[model samples]
Target chain A: MIDFKQEQDGAVLYVDDEQNNINSFRSTFRKEFKVYSAINAVEALKNLKSYPDIKVIISDQRMPDVTGVEFFEKIRHIYPNKVRVILTGYSDIKAVIDAINKGQVYRYIDKPWNNDLVRLAIQDAMDLFDTRKNLSDKNESLQSAYNELDKFVYSVSHDLRSPLMSILGIANLAEVDVQDPKSLEYFQTIKGMVDKLDGYIHQIIDHYKGSQGKQFGDRIDFNKVVDEIIESIKYHPSAQGVKFQVNLEQSDSFLSNKMNVKTILSNLISNAFKYQREEETNKFVEVTGTITSEKAEIIVKDNGVGIKEDKKEEVFNMFYRAKQDETGTGLGLFIVSEAIEKLAGSIDLRSTFGKGTEIKLILPGTSE
Target chain B: MSDKLSIVIVDDNEIDLMIGERLLSRVDQSIALTKFNHSTEMLNWLQREDENSFTTNTIFLVDIYMPIFNGYYVAEQITQVFDAFDKKAIIYLVSATIEISDNRKLMLNSRVEGYIGKPVTVSLFKELIKKHG
Candidate 1:
């Protein structure tokens, strides 16, 4: 599908110790391309240096000082983007074979080559050269853009956090300076606002960290991490009266970024408990999971204050809370959703206003 | 005197440098810290100090991006000057940068002892001191 319609002005250098071989190429390709002849690798290199627009170089396998394979290998380091090809006779079959494999010879033609085929091969090499150059140019631009964004983010975060630090410091000072009860309350509120700002900064940092994918991933015991989280929450005085039950499907060997998954699950489980129904005497949460061939399905069910069906979608949005009584940044569910998405997972919620809420997560498994 | 860890924090913002210094002092009173708002001054001070008597137990807390010279260049100088400081003068990059690659690139430098994200809390500071102290 190469468009040969364009005036192909590029030249091809033909190198051979024998004058007859070089003459054959010159006579064959002189009409279509500007064919340049070289006696050996020395002459070929000289021609290459002089004529930078030489897009392809066809050389004979048998040479006086160096074989075509060795010559191409040396040239590859110097002119890496140049397309190379080897022409060999029946006697130099092994040399040509080695040249093709080791030197990345674009194409090989036997001693007696068809004029049409040789022309076609040169055309193909020119097209390949064009494609590779275009791709390399695009790659360079993309890398520059990536670096610029990285620089901007680094400076922005650093600049933004410095002011936030000043705000928190002033708040800390005011907290001690204020004596009135209502003024103290206002300072406390200011402290809370500063803390929320700190949380947003932390979110930006975490978001940047998560963008790195994972640096280290190993087989982690999910049950151990889950148990530790559960134990930590259970020790909280809030869990004094609530009856807790755990039905864990043993050995949840998931191929995931453990820290991210832990964050996601801990938030979901804790939220389940936090929004418990006031009317229901029995405060309970159920966590369950099943692994399929392609994914791991996890369900966190709680008999707590449930979300109205209309607001189910809103919970995952940033700074979203269902009620005024809730004291949270509302970023937890949003962070959880981001974490789950990173694992190539989907989340769904089922809830009744006063009954309970159930969250289903389907995360990618180790499978082709 | 021997037990105290000498440290320097280089940042552009005065408030951040003060808070960082305060947090470090709160964590451990023994930590004698020198703060610099300009990275150039810090670099010059480091160069001058290296020619003089620079201790082996000193550590640097640097912000990655600064005017004129950045943390990367400062880290490069630290690596060369502190040839014998394999376990000393750890350059812990403290910034709020969200670019993971930037952090990763810094981590590639052996002189960069550790990385702590910005708005570095007292809790994290305590953990860092415990680990490196």
Candidate 2:
């Protein structure tokens, strides 16, 4: 249901070889629209070039120099947004088909056209044109906003890390010269605080980068990815003494964004290592991945402290932590969820309170 | 082979320079340590030194983020001088920033031997010296 009255304000161009037909068209729709009349295709092109606001172009099929379809095809690239309509005196089904396929005409008008039908067609065309313009403008603004945010994140993180690094450096130097045990303990505490801050800053950087949704399609080797992540995180104090079992079943490589997969695995594995029961001696984390032609599935199961059933739903939300773990920033799972969503994946959690937790993820084999 | 090791550290932050000096001194008390808060000053000093001064094994730790001349530029300049002087210089890029892309770009350069994250620890310093010394 188009607002015909509002759409009537849009400019319409009428191209006809006969002066009488052009005059009659102008006389009929002149009150309803800002009508611009052209006696031939050449004149119509000139009018189109001069008036950028013309939303619709109506041309007669049988013309002296060129047919209406030919004119529409020629100007389609230049004025793509302008909706085209065909007018003919005969039934010419072949010409109408050609017009629809080649010229992309909105509608074909018969010789004795109903004024109301033609007005409705023009209104619809104008509405479509306005909708397209609004969408494109919105997309442009959103892209610019995203780019600004990216630059802001990059610069802000760099500035914040600069002074923090200086503090860490000074602390490191001081630690070496201090002989008193208490003073050394204080320096160690300072170092720990700085390391925690550094970890938080890294998470912020990762979150911003992951949210950009820029996908880099590359061949994924799950074995290599899991091994690298384990190697990197194995040295963390929290990961100490936790046995890791990796089983990659897919022999063939899959295609996906490597960074996204890395982030997902890193966050999940780190969490699996972090939320362990101190009293449990048989602590083990198992990562298993399988890829078929259609999709890839990864399952991470840990025999450690598990999540409470009631609070499981809230774990994916930003800054949502189940326990009073000061070291956990609550951003890890949120970032993991975002990465999975961007990859067109779904995650399911199965956990028994004080027993264990297991997460299974299914992702599309290829990105859209 | 009796030539002692020479260490040159260029960073814009005064605190970082002091830290680096202390760290290097702790690594080896007798090793020659030169610290510059500005890249241009380091470049000027290097230019003034005689050719024989670079005959000894030397290591340069350049901070990537600076006001004018960045670590990449300094590393490139050092490589150029090394090529002219026909000597090998081990140039390591150090930065507090966590931008992996920037670090990757720096590592791709043939002149850059390695990239170290900021707040250099004693163990890291010892490992680098042993591996590259």
**Per-residue accuracy of model 1 over A1-368 as CA lDDT, tens digit each:** 01132357677888889888777777767778877879989988999999888899898888879988788988898898999988887898876676677746878888778898888989998898899889999999999997987666665566676677567665555554567889888877886776666656666656555665563254445567678779857865446566776665644455667667777787888788778877688888888876544566778998888999888889999989787865567888888888887877899899988899999988776532
lDDT (Cα, 0-100) at B113 in candidate 2:
83
lDDT of each: 0.75, 0.83
Worst 10 residues of 2 chain A by lDDT: A1-10
DockQ numbers for every candidate? Answer: 0.25, 0.70
TM-scores of all candidate predictions against the true structure: 0.68, 0.85
Give the runs in model 1 whose Cα sits over 4 Å from its true position: A1-6, A89-103, A214-217, A224-254, A259-263, A266-297, A310-348, A364-368, B1-12, B16-133
Best model number under DockQ: 2
Model 1 docking grade: acceptable
The native-contact fraction of candidate 2 is 0.79
Deviation from native of the Cα of residue B82 in model 2, angstroms: 4.0
> How close to the true structure is residue A211 of candidate 1, measured as C-alpha lDDT?
61
